[model samples]
Target: MRKILFHLSLILLFSSCISNKRITYLQNLSDSTAIGLEEFIPFAKVDYKYILQPFDIVQIDFASSDPTLVEGFSFQRPMQQGMVGGGGGQGSDPLYMNGYSIDESGMVEIPRIGKVEIGGLTEEAAKNLVQEKINAYFKDDVYVRLRIAGIRYTTLGEFNRVGVQVIYKNRATIFDALANSGETSLLGKKNKMFLIRQYGEGTKIHQINLNDRALLGSPFYFIQPNDILYIEPMKIRQFGSADNLTASLALFGGVFASVLLIVNLVTGGI
Candidate 1:
């Protein structure tokens, strides 16, 4: 019986302890080459440009010397909150309604410019296409500005906060996304996190290993709009609450004491 308890304690000690390597991010960057890990590739970082996709919302601003010329092209103004007469005013408009959504056919239907195809094009390319059409309408006097509304993403599984989040920015990195979403919990498998992203053809699943330094050179380092980040829990998490060494030792101690009490009771009866 004592021998069984000794083996059990050994098993629990080895299995329930969470290691620093499993929780740390961007490990072994300087010694990556020496450790037989993949070297950082330069071209992958240079060639990355986010392409516009269908269902994406973009804010378009048309500016001109004559305000009336661009009035029809303006989106509805979001409601301002204040005391109106004796009661409060209207609340702010929904974010989606503030910008024009790209239709299934990859076209944005403007008031006079009609439907212009901008999907599959980069942000610069899309801006140029829209600028050309605006130039034709106002004869080059009208200035057209275009940008994605926000970097919207969703976090699921093992995150401190799980749900949709939107950051009003042109571009956001994976770290930014994680930080904005309250970051992952200790039990989350940083090495096993995966990303679900949308593409022109369809959606694709990309694996992201935060524990690896090679991730810096990967395109997945930067998160795209409507991306879903899912983190699976570590397998060791199921053994017990091993978030820290103190917790693991306390849990092992409790189990050890409980077994000892049971053994004493059985021996006393015998």
Candidate 2:
């Protein structure tokens, strides 16, 4: 009986040491304070302005009194005609077919407008620059709308669905990305989520704790194009507990052994 008790005590001690405290996010806030806030606090003080980069697709739409005359400025894809008795089919997305790509030289070649340097400029600034150029050609009130084709980001590490995700939106938050990718798995270390961002001539990495409300004020609250989000695996995952099956079996085995030892001691068999 003493031997069985000693083994059970050791099991409990080891289990306590392998706690999930590190995995929990935002441990500083009290449950009451976090849930009692009435008004929604703004996560970001200013709007996130995404800068243009090389290989980014830019879509420009023109609106004016005469739409037909300004059609030359917009991108158009040629419809595939039935050459061998097949009907004409729709082609790829208009944005990809006709959108302008920012070259390595930080310029986008517009039809009849020549190369315009838009790299390193925010989307709003790029739109204004393009609008100014369009005004020179058209005398009428030509409204110009410009935007990035999509916000592309990559997910790595312990995420359940890991790959490059292209979200079409003017603004996307980190939580949006996680939700879109089916949310993080149990093995994902939410406290160690890393956001890798690209800056001029270099890059910066920021660690985020998803469990903490303090992440709301973080600059990385809004994700940018080409950013990489990596969720590290929990430390416990290294010891063959990456999946529920393994953990369950281990737990069952421990309980079974404890039971066997107790029965053997009571029966005077071992």
Candidate 3:
């Protein structure tokens, strides 16, 4: 009986041991190369510049030598209580409150400039277009700045925390998305990360293998606004029938107890 129990425990332990191949990320690359990792072939020759879309919130700001001239174009709202400003304070700023949502028609109505069609344009292209209009009004002394108000994304499945995240950076990567969501849990399958992206009229899904360095060259490397990232669970997690360590241990314990009871009953004694 002792021997049976010991062997069963050993089997459970060995089954639970996850292979390094399944957990380790960027496994295809070698550290012995003389070139720095940064110098490696840049990811995605496909342009990562996100195009404007309907319902996308955009923040547009103008700076000029004369504050009064551009003041009419800016609007400010009271900062909400408990909402800290980006620079680390409760101080209010006009741009934060004055985000312009792109209408279904892909146009933003400027105060003096009227309606500007920016729907299909990249942020840089939109900026230049807006700058040209601003230039027509103010000549040389003014500068225009434009950006997506926030890079909003959602993470689901096999993550420690899953929710919609709004990142402030203009450019973010898949790694950035994972890091923001408290990173993936132990069961999160690095090789099966899925990126669901909006393309034109419909949506498309792309598989990303985080364990392979070659993923660095994929077009999906940089995350786009409104992207949905779903991290799959390792097969072991499914086989173990538990999403977490405590649950797995409890499940194992219950199975062991059941086997012990069966053994004792068969022998008519402990």
Clashing pairs in 1: none
What tens digits encode model 2's per-residue C-alpha lDDT throughout 154-194? 88888766777767777888987887666777777787899
Q: Alpha-carbon error at 204 in model 1, in Å? A: 2.8
lDDT of 1 by residue, 35-141 (tens): 34465456345464667988888888889898889999987776745412111113332456568889988899988999999999888899999999988888648
**Steric overlap count per candidate:** 0, 3, 1
Q: Rank the candidates by TM-score, best first.
A: 1, 3, 2
User: Candidate 3 versus the native: TM-score?
Assistant: 0.78
Considering TM-score, which of the candidate structures 1 and 3 is the better prediction for this target?
Answer: 1
C-alpha lDDT of all candidate models, in order = 0.78, 0.74, 0.77
Worst window of 10 by summed lDDT in candidate 2: 82-91
lDDT of 3 by residue, 183-242 (tens): 787777888888999866678899888887776677877899989989888667765533
Consecutive 10-residue window with the lowest summed lDDT within model 1: 83-92
Error of 1 at 16 (Å): 1.6
Each model's TM-score?
Answer: 0.80, 0.75, 0.78
